[model samples]
Target: MIYLDYVSTTPLNQEVNHMYQSLLNDYFANADSLYSLGLKTSALMEKSRELTAQLLHVLPEEIIFTSGASESNSAAIKGCAFQYQNRGKHIITTAVEHSSVYQSCIQLRDVFGFEVDFISVDASGNLDLKQLEEAIRPDTILITMMYVNNEVGMVFPIEKVYQMIQKINPKIKLHVDMVQALGKMPIDLTHVDLASFSAHKIYGLKGSGVLYKKTSTSLVPLINGGQQEHQLRGGTSNTATHTMFAKTLRLALENLEQKYQYVTSLNHYIREQLTQIPDIVINTPSEHVSPYILNFSCVGYKPEVILHALEMYECYVSTKSTCSSHKSDISRTLQAMGIREDIAKSAIRISFSHHTTQDELDEFLFYLKKTLKTIKKQR
Candidate 1:
């Protein structure tokens, strides 16, 4: 199948798979154990942590490993809110944040007695820095926003937001969910206080991610057990996954410059072709989007219907967040971006990876055009 759903999860590369296999065979002991085998596993885990820290431009002590973005987000939001509640019971975030970030704050509000103020987004899905600044009260301790929106591929102005926050409240913690932006963009962690990352999104193994916190920042532990992952996340580490994650990150970075240009060209070609067709509108902004993902709406067709039609031609696409695929609700992202409900319902997301080829995109175009024609005829 032609997988156009790379944003959800990418298949593991051969090199990553080999690393997984090697770790599984040679280092199977739990890192928490005190034995020699455990020491070997612990050393491997530390090495992986160092590599991840290097990638994110943070100190190794600041990196906390977790299951994925969801857990990392939870740990970042809840951990910070709970720990710093006395400083402020208020938090700031955007209306278009991922459910992981949104739901985590909702839980904090509902269960922990914290107040969350949501900033609005512009039509292009960029957060309103002025509105965000206005939302920050004396009690406001954190600002969480996604670097790259999952559904629309909009690249939020992270540096601008950070600068705005710095001007108003230098003590306010900055948290970014960089799940979709990790390898696609160069993240210099010099400015960002805490950021969430997932290995699976970058063609690495699943169940491996990092939560990077600045040296002065403190976060409570999510999982309670042994003193691992700087004592912020506790459990026996996933040695194999960690090893593959580090190795895969290195592999992903090797061709990142080339991949960026390639994906931009591909997105431009697809956007041009699709825009030429009747009743189609590109949802993502041309200037401020990562080329890896393209979101659009077709006026005459529903997303689910077109998704199924594309599947028949062995072309895979997604309608909404894969995490909440079973929900069957309208996208919170599109809604926050002020898209009409009808248009949002008709939106479909097509994401690509380094493995995707131009020939595959051409084939997808052929099937997509045929499907659109069929849809229009029915209308």
Candidate 2:
């Protein structure tokens, strides 16, 4: 099968799998137990945290391991709101964020009565800085945005946003979802207050993730059954997965620059070929976008039609974020960029990994064009 859905999830890297297996079989003791075996396991976990922290350039204590990015996003947003509510109840975010961030913000506004301002993006999927500045208030507590958009690969200007926040409200916290950006590009979280990452997004195991909370930043615990992750999250830990986080990150970042340049050529090849097709419009912008993902629309055809037709040839792609791809809604991400309804409703997302090849892309295109022709005849 030609799999082109890396943004949704990636197959586990063999090296990371080996690390996980070693820990699972020999070091299975609970990290929190007071016994000698548990103490040794706890040391291993701390070492993992230290290495992950060093790689990400943060304090070891700052890394809070959780189930995945969705839980991390919810914990960061809600925990911040609850812990620091006395400071403010207002928050700011972009309209094109992943569903995890968008829905978390929605929960704050709809269920908890917090004021949320979702800043809209321009047609090219870039945020309006002036509009963002106007939206910030004395009560605005946090601004959560994604580092790289999963659907269209738009890279939000988090540095500029951080600078703007310092000028407007020095107290406001900045949180970013780094799932799509973590393995695709280098990250510096020095100026960021909180960030979320999923191991699965970077070719590691699923059901494991990290939330980087600055040492000085205070967040009320999101989970409270016991004292783990500095009372931030509760429950028995997934020891094997958590301990291998550092290796997972290390392998993903290896040769990243070379991998990126090679993938750019692949993306360029597909983008050129897709533009020549009838009734197809590219949704991903050419500028300030990650080369790992490309999105386009087959205007007259529903996404499900094209997807099913392509599946007959064992080709695979996706629509928008996988969190909401199963639903029939038009892409809110494309809609926020002011794309036409015909295009937005028919958007298809194709993501790539360094493992993707030119031959796979060529075969994918052959099947894709054949599917479009079949649909045209049906019409």
Best by lDDT: 2
**Per-prediction TM-score to the true structure, in the order listed:** 0.97, 0.98
Query: How many backbone collisions does model 2 have?
Result: 0
Candidate 2: Cα lDDT at 179:
91
Clashes of each: 0, 0
lDDT of 2 at 229: 91
Q: For model 2, what is the error of residue 31's alpha carbon versus the real structure, in angstroms, after optimal superposition?
A: 0.9
Output the lDDT of residue 30, model 1. Answer: 90
- What are the clashing pairs of model 2? none
List, residue by residue over 1-379, the lDDT tens digit for candidate 2.
8999999999989988887888898888888999998998889989989999999988999999988999999999989988888988999988988888899899999999999999999999999889999999999999988999999999999999999988989899999999999978989898899999999988998999999999889998878978889888888877888888888998899999999999999999999999998888999999999999999998888888888888888888997789997788888889999999888988999999999999999999999888888785323
* Candidate 2: segments with Cα more than 4 A from true spot: 376-379
